[model samples]
Structure formats: C-alpha cells, structure tokens
Target: MKNLANNVGVSTIGIATFFLTVVVVVLIEHFTTFNIFTLSFFIVFPAGALICGAAAASGYYFGALWLHRRPTILIFVQILLVAAIAQFAIYYGEYRLLDLGDGRMASDVVSFKDYLDVYLSSTHLRVGRGALDTGAVGNFGRVLAFTQFLGFIVGGIFVFVMLRVYPVCEQCARYLRILAKKTQLFSKQEDFTRFYDTVFEVPVDGPDFVTLMKWQQEKDEKAVRGTIQSETTLRGCPHCKTQRISQEIKVWGEKEFRDVPQLTRHLRIPDGIDLTSAFKTV
Candidate 1:
C-alpha cells in the first residue's frame, strides 16, 4: 500500500480534476436536456461514475510510474470516495437550480431528508414509476451506489490488464531495448586408441636373473566439448540496469548457414562455437 499522506499532491490534483469534470458535466446537463441514460436519475450520476473511474485509473497509473507500486484496494476505495463526493455535488447543484416555493430554491432551506424526497420523486417521474415511499427511495439510492461502484472497478481492471500484457521489462518495469541478435552452432568429437605396455617385472636371482611381462591397454582418449547452436536475442533494460538473453536452440543435425553478408558474418562469431579457441590446434 502507498502512504496516502505522502501522496497528498497527487491525490489533491486528482480530486480537483474530478470535481472540475463534474462541474462541466453539471453545467451541460443544466443548460441542455442531456440525459446520460434515457431513464431519469440525471446525467450527473453516470457522468460522475465515468469521471470517478477515470480518476481511479489515472491514480493507479501514476502510482505505478512514480512509486513503482499500484495498491489496488486503496485505489478502489479512493474511487468510491470520489464517486460519493461527486454525487453529493451533483445533488447540491441541482437543488440550487430548482425553485422550491415562493421563488425560493431548496438550496436555501431544504433539509437533507426533504432533498431526498424531492430527488426520488423526480427520479420516479423520469422513470415513469408511481410514487415511492421513503423506504423505496433509500433502496434505490443503494442500488445506484452499487452500480457506480462497479463502473469504477471495471475501469481499474481494464487499465491493470493493459499494463500487464504490454511488452515491458519485468525487472525495471520499462520497455526493453534489443541489443543484439545472433545464431550459434555447437559440435563435439571423440578419439580412442589401443596400445600395449609392459605390465610387470620379477627378479629370479639376486645377482643377475630378471623376468618381464607385457599387457594390452587402451589410452589417449579425447572428446570434443559439446557446443550449443542457437539463435539468441540480447535485451537490456535502461531503468533497472539489467540485461536479458533469450535463445532458441537449433535442432540437432541441422546444417548451419549465415544469411548475413560475408563482411558482416566475418565481424560476428558463429552461433555456438568460439572461433578463437575452436581454431586453435594442440
């Protein structure tokens, strides 16, 4: 998890951007009859949900980029908080725009309970439903809250999956740079020989007598080191100061060939064997 207090700057900027988006959406709804959903509930609710999701995704991206960590649970909670605040702002904006009675707006004097009653009544009218009691209105509010929360989750997951599947270096969390590509071939050789040698000798008499025997033996066996032939790519990560070598070994008994120009081939080593040592004669 991230230290929320330490990220106050980013959080503050994110909150401010969300509210700004909400205000623009509210103004558009107020001046024009633009309902996000054909069913009532005002355009503000869906607009707020979208803004909240976007804000949450941005938060997660920035957290990963700057802090090298994305705290999924914390970001989700932050999204919910942003959505709730946006909903309240939308309600308050609409309340001020509405004339309650005697040329007075609900923003001037209406209590929270009275606001809910008015808001729910308008919702019912827009949805073509009959009057709803306080209990029904409360239930509808919970359902709306739940749907908005789901929107935030969907947005967060979308961005998270994109980041994971993207071609990036695991260690540095940055894009990888291809350093080199080459193919190699490996070979081995063995040699064996049979020979005879004196096996033992015995003394028959202390002064002059001696005997000798011979035996057959195998010796001077030699084996060439196994060589690996492969096509390999060398990649480096600039951010984490690391390198990765990826190789695809050629199948055994395959003939090796160089596709590059002769000059280029001369400059590069063959895939599997080291030319300097392989060419040396013993």
Candidate 2:
C-alpha cells in the first residue's frame, strides 16, 4: 500500500514535470529560433536533442530519488512513455503558440496533423552561420524524427543506468545515505593484496579491522606504474541502521588509472559497528 501510494505520488510529479518541460522547450525554440529536438552541431551527433531529452527525463530521475524507486521493467516502460508524451506535448504546444503573421495563430487555422506536416516541410537545417539546404522535405522530416526518437530512447537508458549505479536500501525502501569515502594507496602489489585481505578476510570486529580503521588519511594523487589505488565508499540506511562498504581497485595505466573489475568487493557492516574512527577526515 505504501509503495503504491508512493508510485502514485511520483507519477503525479512526473506528469507535472513533463508539462513544465514541454512549455519551456516550446518557448525556447520559439524565441531562440533553435529546434532542440532536431539540433545537431557536430556531424551525426544530436547534442541538442540529447540535452532536450535529459531535460525531459529529469522528472523521472528526481521522482525515483524521492521514493527510492528501484528501476524495473515497468519503470523503464513508464520512462519511455513519458518521453513519447513529452515530445508530443512540446510539438503541439509549439504549434499552438506559433504566430503565422497578421495576428493569426497556427492552431486557429489548421489541425494538429496539418500543422505538423507544414512545420516539417518548412523546416531547414542550420549549418554554421547559414541554413543548410535539406534536399527533400520528406527526407529531412524523416531524419529529424529519427534523431528525436533516438535521443529520447538514449536518455531513458541513461536514467536507468544512473538508478542502477546508486546504492539503495531495499529493506527501508530508500536510497542509502553515503557516509564516507576513503582511499588507500599502496606502492607495491603485495602490500595492496595484504590490505585487501585485511579488509575483506578479517571480521568487522577483529583486531586487524580496528587497526585499519585507525589508519591516517592519505592524499589522493595520480597512481604510478607500480602503485595500486583502493577507493572505499561507505553507505548506510537511516531507518534500519544497516551499513555497506564497497571497495574498487585501480591500477595505473600509461595515461590513467584503470579499474580492476575482479578486485571490486561490497561488504555489509554488522549493526552497531562504530565507524566514526575510520572516517576522521570525512
């Protein structure tokens, strides 16, 4: 029942956000003479469309955080629906608001379908400082439609990716609060391995664990070839008081630090475990 109510609330907020985004997008395009849905400055890259999509997807992102929504297939479908509706709303809103000279509104004279056809036929691509001639109206309209659709789909996928990466407290039905983030650097591979073993192999309340917790904070810098970097993130559920720690290992590459996927680990901290001393700098 609680989840249902939360879902309803999120849905309402999302709807409101969708309308707001549509209005803003329409106004922006009207005043600026820039069509975000079909904008592409770089060759084959729909930068403006993606930005518009991100704007449209913000509602779903915040709504999820409001109730700690776990992204499911249903949520994914809802996001896509929101994307489709939002795009339609923007197009229609723009059509209605358009002034077709001599105090005439586009919507007052023509139906939405007719207006859409005219709009697409009249649309031209802007290249640099001049307009680029799109040979045929039909081909240009098709390309525009394809770019807009692809951008929204990619935006929906990004929302899901973000939600999945964030840690959530399933028991409390809330997003986990990040407690602290600490990093440890090692000059030798064997030293890092020992450090890894100490943290993962030893029990939370063990002597080695306490020793590690008391270690002084280290300054973060670019890793050298022989150096190993371990980044630890601590998060907790406020309601249930459950804590989780995740560690990611990185090895120095020719230009940057590359992640060691196999070295990543996530561990649950027992309740009542005092972590204050470990995060002195936090």
Candidate 3:
C-alpha cells in the first residue's frame, strides 16, 4: 500500500506538471514559430491520466481494503473519487477567481480557458455581436500579464512540490532499469527498454509508451544490439506517460563545491550487460 501510494502519488505529480505545461506550451506555439511535434507534445498531452492511473493504483494497492469496503467496482470507484476531487479543485479555483458573490454568472462567459486569446490579446477589438466587446475586462491584458508572471512562480512551486512528494518517475526509472539489467531475468529485456525508453526517454511527442515489451521482432532486435548507458536527463514524453528528461547541466560558481563522490549515488551503471545498451535498455 505504501509502495502504491508512493508510486502513483509520484507519477501523478510528474504527469500533472507535464500535462499542465501543455497549455502554456500550446499557447506559445500558437503565437510563435514552432514545429508540429512541439505543439503536439507541449499542447495536447493529457496529463489527467496520470492522476487516473494513480487513483487506480491506490485502489489496487489496498486490494482487500477496497474489496471489503466497496466490493463490486472498487478500483473504478476510487478512480471516480479522484476524478471528482480533481474536478472540484479546478472548479473551485475557477470560481474563486471569476465568480462574483451575487446571483449572477461570472464576468467571463465560459470557463475551460478557451477564450484566453480573446482575453489576453484583446487591446481594442471591433465587435460584430455588440457595439463594443462585452467580454472585455478593462486593463485585462495587463492583469493577465501580471497573472502570467504569478503563474510561472506558482507552476515552479507546484513542480517542486510534485518532485518532492512523488517518486521522481525519472529517478525511479533509473533504478528499475538497473535492477532489470542486474537480474537479467526477462526474455524481452531489449524490447522492454525500447518501449520503456519510448515511455520514459526525453519525449518529443507526449513527448510516449507502455507494455514494457511487446515481443515484436524489430523491438527485440533493437534491444540485443543497442548501445547502453544509464541515461540521465529531463526531456520529452513521446506518446505515453512521460519522464521529462532534460540535460542536467552543471552550473559553475565562484565558490567551488566539494566533489564528494556523492552526486553519483542517484546514477547507476548496471553490470554484466551489453554495457552499450544501458541507455537504450536492450
């Protein structure tokens, strides 16, 4: 149970962060010069599934608890509970910001943020439906700009919160691969890595992957002949759940820090494998 919560909780945080990022990234792509891949990864990824998966995992973790308490559809019930909770949070945030304490609707017509463009870029829009833009919030753009600044700070904090609370899916992945290699137990370890990398490697598309190994011939071959290394990164998500694998650039400073052989703890280089396939995981 502890393990499941830790696993799902951690995954939820990472997935939510990446998923939430899609909104900002999409808006950026829409307003800037970027590629389709960038837009797809940055904008379209549904991070909510991580939350869903976590909730499901939680139910599974407490197998007897759920079965004894809720029985018929225990896991499904837990998932619904989480869904309700998430919806409540999003709705509460929206209402807290937009709702006026009168018997009236919000100043904004619709919610779901589809009208961000209309709200943010609206300097002096000429209207067709009315003489002036009824949707206008005076000095709203400035307000939005300020909010955007706040959003980054909030997002940063949220990301930190997620990283701290969760298992650091990327980090956990390092150990999983190392363990897999050390055990050398599975027949399709190679296929597993390819799929796993697609799932965990710096994603370009959700930036994606699952089924650890599918038994395809190409996937099989790629594993056995692949170059190996314990890849350390914070980058993309492909088309599956992601582990944002970016390059960990070491920053220099005037005060030299001690090299205590400590930083290596988080990284692992497995033994008795192709050695080259460490990164690729075949």
Best by lDDT: 2
Question: lDDT (0-100) at residue 85 of candidate 3?
Answer: 43
TM-score of 3: 0.22
- Best model number under TM-score: 2
Tens-digit per-residue lDDT, 74-140, candidate 3: 3334433443343223333333344345755453556645343444555332334453544544565
* Candidate 1 residue-wise lDDT, 1-282, digit = tens: 345554554456456655765566567667785533212244225544654456544554554444433344655566556644655566566666766559887767877668856565444223325534334344465466556656555554555555444345665566545665544343421111111011011221111211111111123422133333335455555565455544343333334443322212112222332222211210
Number of clashing pairs, model 3?
A: 33
Better of 1 and 2 by TM-score: 2
The TM-scores, one per candidate, come to 0.43, 0.78, 0.22
Model 3 Cα displacement at 268 (Å)? 31
The global Cα lDDT (0 to 1) of model 1 is 0.45
lDDT, each prediction? 0.45, 0.74, 0.34
Worst 10 residues of 1 by lDDT: 191-200
Positional deviation of 102 in candidate 3, in angstroms? 17
